[model samples]
Structure formats: C-alpha cells, structure tokens
Target: MKQNIHPQNHEVIFYDVNSGYKFLTHSTKTSSETMEWEDGKLYPVIKVEVSSDTHPFYTGRQKFNEKGGRVEQFKKRYNM
Candidate 1:
C-alpha cells in the first residue's frame, strides 16, 4: 500500500431527483453543496438525474412506441 497515493474516499449523498431517493455512500467525487447528516457531520451532496430508484427498467414503468402504426401510415400515403 502506498501512502497518500489514493484519492480520499469521503462520505457523500446521491440524491435521485425523480424519485426523491437519497443514498449515503463514499466516493472521491466533489460537490459544492454540503449536508449535515444525523451524526452532525457535513458531507457533500450530489444530485443525479437518474438512478435505480427511479429508472424505468427497475421500476417496471418503461415506455415504448409501436413502430407498426407509423410504418403503416407512411406506406399508405407513399404507396410503398
């Protein structure tokens, strides 16, 4: 093990905006906003747009469009 060679792993909060989910983890990322946890210590808070908590795949809310409808309409108009 090398001394002072690895980046600091500090406490951080990953906030999912869509689901309003919060998770505490350690990472080397930096954030300008700070949050005081239950332990009364200030940690960096990072807001993310998407995470497993709100992702369509994990939540079983994924949306998809049917291409057959559009293709039929286009073929009828263009005679293709």
Candidate 2:
C-alpha cells in the first residue's frame, strides 16, 4: 500500500437534522461547524438529513408505494 495515500480519519460528530440525533464516529469527512459533545469536548459537527434514528427502514415506518408496475403507472397517468 502506498503511504499517505488515504485520507486521515478523525473523531467527528454526525447530527441528524430530522430526529435531532447526534452520534460520534470516526470519519474522513470534516466540517467547519463545531458542537460540544456529551464528553464535554468540542468536535466538528456534520449535519445530515437522515440517519438510522429517523430513517424509515430503521424506524419501521417505511411506506411501500406498491402502485403496481410500469404498465400500471402508465395506465394511471393516461387515465386508462
């Protein structure tokens, strides 16, 4: 493996916007925003739109849009 070819991983905080959930993890992603974590230390915060806390699959609130197949959609679109 080539040296210095990989990005550096740092302890970062991911904040879920929808559920207001926050978690600490290591990632190569960095951010300019900072937030005080539960450990009483500041860490870079990366805001995310969705996380396991609010994700439909994880929350068991997934909605199935089983409106048939492509043919059914086409028919519905044409009012057939």
The lDDT per prediction is 0.80, 0.88
lDDT score for residue 19 of model 1: 66
User: Residue-wise lDDT of candidate 1 within 1-80, one digit each (tens)?
Assistant: 77999898878988876566878899899799987777888889999868887678888985333336878969977999
RMSD of each: 10.5, 8.9
Report the number of the highest-TM-score candidate.
2
lDDT of 1 at 64: 31
| Steric clashes per prediction | 0, 0
Question: What tens digits encode model 2's per-residue C-alpha lDDT throughout 1-80?
Answer: 78999999989999987667999999999999999999999999999977898778888995433568889989999999
- Cα lDDT over the full model 2: 0.88
Worst 10 residues of 1 by lDDT: 62-71
Off by over 4 Å in 2: 62-80
The collision pairs in model 1 are none
The CA lDDT at 47 in model 1 is 94
